[model samples]
Target chain A: MSPLVEFRSVERTYPSRQGPLHVIRDVSFTIERGGILAVVGESGCGKTTTGKIAAGLVDPSRGTVLFDGENISGFKGPELSRFRRRVQLIHQDPYSSLNPVRTVYQTLAAPLKRFRLVKNRTELLHKVRELLLTVDLTPPDDYLYKYPHQLSGGQRQRVAVARALTVNPDFIIADESVSMVDVSIRSSLLNMLLRLNQELGVAFLFITHDLSVARYFSWRGKTAVMYLGRIVEYGPTPEVTRLSAHPYSRALVASLPVSDPRVARLRAQDDEVGSPDVPSIQNIPPGCAFHPRCPLYMAGSCDRDVPELMGMRESESLHQVACPVVLTR
Target chain B: MSIRSDSAPPASVDGATLMSVRDLSVVYRVGNRLVRALSNVSFDVMPGRALALIGESGSGKSTLGSALTRLLPRTAEITSGSITFNGKEGRVQLLDLSSEELRRFRWRDCAVVSQMAMNAFNPVMTIQDHFEDTAAAHGLRDKAKIHDKAYELMETVHLDAKRVLPSYPHQLSGGMRQRVLIALSLLLSPELVILDEPTTALDALSQRAIIKLLRRLRQQLGLTMIFISHDLSLAAELADDVATMYAGQIVEYTDVFSLFDKPKHPYSVGLIGAIPDLSADGASLVSIPGSPPDLVSLPSGCRFHPRCPLSDDKCERELPLLVETEPGQKVACFHWKDAQTLKGSDAFEGRNS
Candidate 1:
């Protein structure tokens, strides 16, 4: 299956006070058509930045992102606008995502009007109601005249989702969209995305810090484990989850609260506190950026040279892990 | 690794309730109509024990927290609810507290470290300034006394007292700020402390740090706590007892272990199932279909019936009452017995951990 979206050696560097910050370091992955690919990492891991790059909100410092096998990295003008319409980005805060002053009707109508998706007000209103029902925000008429403040948190999130679908984008870059919403409604929202993927053949570049959520979020072409600002491990969710080749991936899995009471009780004794320590991009270590904290680090080799993204010690497909432990083995 | 409880608390309190919440409700008026944020809620908070008020947003978990502290926005009205301190007869209807009484009772009687509560501190103010203000308000006028107490509080939360005392809120990481807030809540050793989503904004490491620190603190001080949160996992990690609230009403209240292991209410089971668990494999994401019912036009029977998979016609017309079944567990579901048949499927098991 060809990918609806593909990242080829994508890198994003931000000019910081002291030097350039390597936000995305030699990252590459793909989201197959109708797939949900989640990039799991802690905050400040450049996961959000990578999502923005895919959505065309941020230009990459190095490499290209292809959509439908087309290199639109430098594409601008009408073509870029069309790409923007075909791709949408959902923000984190639903409360702030919509205009507080406008009613749901106006807010929904504004996008349709801007995109010129509909001309007449009557038809536009009908289309707005259609979008609302599609997202399961039923009895759409009730929400038509309601202001953002009048709606509940879950309702607000649905509005945001409806807004994102206003342009009928085939690909969505949902960046922590559910993190800010209540946990009770979050599952339903994720299910909504799943349904959309299956029903509309839409693709998603989901970004989140919750590892479990990413795993359950369905078959993203590849699931990548990001550390500081690098894709340390990228592979099929099941493969990477079962045999986490990279040290960072191992730590991440171990960090998740064990759902089994027996294991959680035992884990409660370990003091493996995750204190994120990312070196300033400029003053990076000689060989491996993760060597300082890597538990299985072989002193000389790990510190002397950087590891590339490869499935050297594993049956290579899309399962890419950056570690000598796997590579040397 | 750390002690679970500092010391067991005495149950009898001279024949009086430890914490009494009368017809407690909170409403924030937007334009013309009043948004019923919380409606006719009541619960008790006992010393040396925790009662977690669990609910999703707009479910009024934070509103409930703010009501306990008399810190609701000016527009917000405490329609009714008299929160009386256990040790003292100083009863103040959180809604009825006079400005002076609110000033007096703010942190000394019941303190708050709210949701994203790290932002509770003013960014411009130093941690020392926050401590001094709180201590002075409680009559800890001696500068040295306040400073010593603040250092001790920091130590309790594993914060570097010396380094954090002079730093600003912006200077500390999310976890550090949370720890500072927890430390500040202890400044007066307020018998009852209200924490709203204290660890929700934090990472797993920070969350564990807060949870473990709180467990230790509970043992040392025997603090009466009212923990309000949306995250059941964290709630299970800390709260001894849990109360799952919905549409402004508690659906279930029981021991933390039982609540997670076997929930009596459909809403409780759905809440537990909805959480994404990393340890559970192939646990495809499951979301409760449909949104929470509108409180204004609440369903006649169980407010959760519309979205509840177990709902029947009887559930739609007649309301279910919260009846005590087991020793500690209470449920509002008309058919809670059927809930026992809940599968330990990917969506239903929240208690294993």
Candidate 2:
């Protein structure tokens, strides 16, 4: 079967004061049906832009975002509406994405009504409650009539999830969905997404700057590591985090402060983590954009030519990395 | 620094206690209701060690930061307790100090780098003007002296002094603004530095950079730091000691290493469990079940009982006082021993329901 979403060598750029800012370049990936693909990177790495491109919100300057077999950009009118209904984007901030004046019922019901999913008031109410239940906001009566301000941050985020689920989308682009929620309640939200993925077979393009969250949330899924608008590593989540091939990916993984202070203390002492100030998009360094900060940076080859994503030698797993040094090794 | 009971010696034998807080309780008046923002929160900051206050939102972590620097708003009042700073001159009572004295004592004694460093600066003023004002307030009236110090600070923080001095707050990036704020906090070379969620607004790269800078500054300057953060991992990375707060009370206090390895409080265990472990992929996170209790009308017994898995009748009716369960760990949980033995599956079962 065709993948749920596919990015065929996507590139995105915007006209800027410095020049044409290449926010995303030569990125390609696929999300299979019921599979999760976590795109991990720091800010300005084009992870958000990639999510937008997948959602058809931002038209890529080059290449195409394909939903199933067809280009998402080609969809129009009824097709566009269908695509919109089938693909949902869960925003980062729960406070701003939801309307303050709308009741939880209205927020969920509007989408059900817009998509003509329910016929009458009774069905609408039933469907709304069911949507809330699906997102684990139990009993439903306690929260149906409450305004956004009446609920807590986690509750607000659940309502946001319910709003997205009202359309019964097959694919979700959760752009840092749990980043804004309190860390204590973040797991519950992530578990809710996991349940949806398991039970409903919903595919996800989880975008986050946090590698640990990506590792846990997309355990059975694949991970794509982006840096300066390029996918430096793409592979199974566990392998990518544990044995990441690219220097940048290793740096990111090393940068994470483990809960164990023993390990964290050791990591803190290690000077080989994190990149230098990320070069601006207008002036992305030639060759490997990460060469400046890489510990094993090859002076001549790495600085002269950009490396293509290649499979690591002697590794049977489908782990791919974009470092020429690693590839040569 | 081993954990000691509440009855332990108030001051270290070596006089290493830079600041000692005892039974520090703070309350806020929201309209007519009295909100108990902090309840008997006490800890000590050693001369050059870092103390991390880790907790979720509404857990009074930030309130503790504000209270330490006497930056609490008009609504909040410190009803009881004493905060004694062992300054170079002598022991000084922070709570009893007059407003005028506080003005003199604020940055010169202990400084605060609050969250949202961008908003901390005035939009209309250049970065240099802010530095000059701070210098003037501290009685450094000479323009040349202020300029020299400001340049020195910029150099320390790795910002281009020439480019950053004339620029307004908005002209610099979030990381640059945060660096400037840290530099400003260090302008007086205060013994204690209170950093409240210093890098929450920045991206991962910038967060790493700022944290590295802070760690370096602390070492180079021998600064005693109080890092207030909700991120347990970061707390582990930055602080030497960890104090876990819930609702308005401190539930756990110990050295960072001991706290992470053998967490005695259920809340601490739950907090550690909630974090996604990088080593263990697809690990099921065990988040604490219920939300924190309402401060105004708290639970009958322990504030954390409602959400605690090991809570029982005693925990529900009688408030659990902090006890040094071990040499270096103080925990207030009634059944922390059972919690420590109970594996993740047994402890977290039905808790997420």
Candidate 3:
């Protein structure tokens, strides 16, 4: 069967004062039916843009976004509406994503009514309460009439998740979905998503700057690391985190704050290469974007040649890296 | 690592106790109702050492920080407590100071670096103007002397003095702005510095860099630092001691090293287990079930009993006091010893049953 969603060498650019700025470069990946693909990167790395393209919110400047082998750029009218109903986007900030004035019942019912999933008021109320229950907002009646302001951050996020599920979408682009929630209650939300993926067979394109969160939510799934709008590394989540090939990935893994004081104390030393600053996309280096900060950076070739993503260390695993040193090895 | 009594210092701490807080309770008058922001909160910071206040968003960590600096909002009041700070002029009661005396005490004796410090700068003012304004307020009037001191501070924080001095706050990056704020906080060379989630807004790389810089500055300046963060892991790196708070009360307090390896509180264990580890694989994050108790109408006894895995009938009726369970480790849980062996997955098991 064809993958649920695929990016075929997608590239996105925007016109700026400094010339045509390439926000996404040569990005290609796929999310299988009921599978998860976590895109991990920091701010201004185009992860959010990639998520937007997948959700049909933005059109890519170049290349095709395939939905089950059908190019999404060609979608129009009924086809586009069908795609919209099948895929959803959950934003980062629960505080702002929700409509403050609308009651939770209205928020969930609007989607059901828009998709015509429920016929009458009775069905809408029952479906809305069921959606609330699905997202672990217990006793739906208590939460149905409450406004967004009446709920906590975690509850607001749960309502957001429930609203997404109202239309029965097969895929979700959770862009930092739980980042704004408190750490203590984050796991419950993550576990709810996991249950949806398993029981409902919903695919997830989880976008976050946190690698640990990516690994936690998509343990048995795929992970793609982006830097300067490029997919610098891609592989199974365990392989990417446990044995990171890219220097950038290594730096990210090293920089994660571990709970243990003894372990975290020893890692206080600078594990990253080069300067702490990330160079602007407008003034990206000629060769590898990460070469300036790469610990294993070579003097001549690294500064001259742009490396493409390739397999590393003769590994048969799905691990691939875009670094001159790793590609040569 | 063996647990020591509360009085016994950890192997790393050799400095003298700089300040001690006793029975710190803060209440806010939200209209007619009284909201208990903090209740019976107590902790200590030693000279040249860091004490981390760790908790969730509404756990009163920020309230304690504000109470220490006497910067509480108009609605909030310290109902009962004594905050004693050891200064060059000997010990002083911080809460007892008048508004005028408090102004003189602030920035000169203790300083605060909050999450908004980066955005706290006046957007219209140049970096030099900010330095001049702060220094002048603290009684440094000479322009040339303030300029020299500002340049010295910029150099100390690894910023180019000449370039940053002429630029406004909007011109600098998030990391650079934070560094400038830190430099400004140290303008008076205050003995105590309270950092409340200083790097929460920065990226991972910048957060790591800022943490390293703060650690170095704390040691070099011999400053007593109270680093407050929701991230226990990040706090463990910079702090000598860790105090975990929940619902305005401290649940656990111990040396940083011991707190991680053998947390004596169920809440602390649950929090540590909830953190996603980079190296560990196949371990699921475990969340403490149920939300925090409403401060306006708290639970019957133990505020955390509603969500605690080891809670029983006794835990629901009697509020457990912060008692020394081990040497140097204090816990307020009734079943911390039983919860010690519980791992990430096992910590929250049998909850639904």
lDDT of 3 by residue, A97-160 (tens): 9999999998999989888898899988889989988998877888999999888898999999
DockQ of candidates 1 onward, in order? 0.43, 0.60, 0.71
* Whole-model Cα lDDT of every candidate shown, in order: 0.76, 0.85, 0.86
Q: How much is the lDDT of residue B345 in candidate 2?
A: 30
Instruction: Report, to 2 decimal places, the DockQ of model 2.
Output: 0.60
lDDT of 2 by residue, A1-329 (tens): 88888999999999988879999999998889999999999878999999999999999999988998899898999999999999999999999999999999999999898889999999999998888889877778888999998887888999999998989999999999999877778987898899999999999999999988999888899999999999999988888888888888877876776788777656644437434466666678899998887778878888889989888887899899999888887
**Worst ten in a row by lDDT for model 1 chain B:** B1-10
Q: For candidate 1 chain A, which ten residues in a row score worst on lDDT?
A: A268-277
Residue range B67-110, candidate 1, lDDT tens digits: 77778888888765556556564544555567897787767778
Best by TM-score: 3
Instruction: Tell how far residue A31 is off in model 2, in angstroms.
Output: 0.4
Q: Model 2 reproduces what portion of true contacts? A: 0.67
Can you give the lDDT of residue A122 in candidate 2?
96
lDDT of 1 by residue, A24-108 (tens): 8888888877787889887667899999899888888999999888887767899898998899898988888899999988888
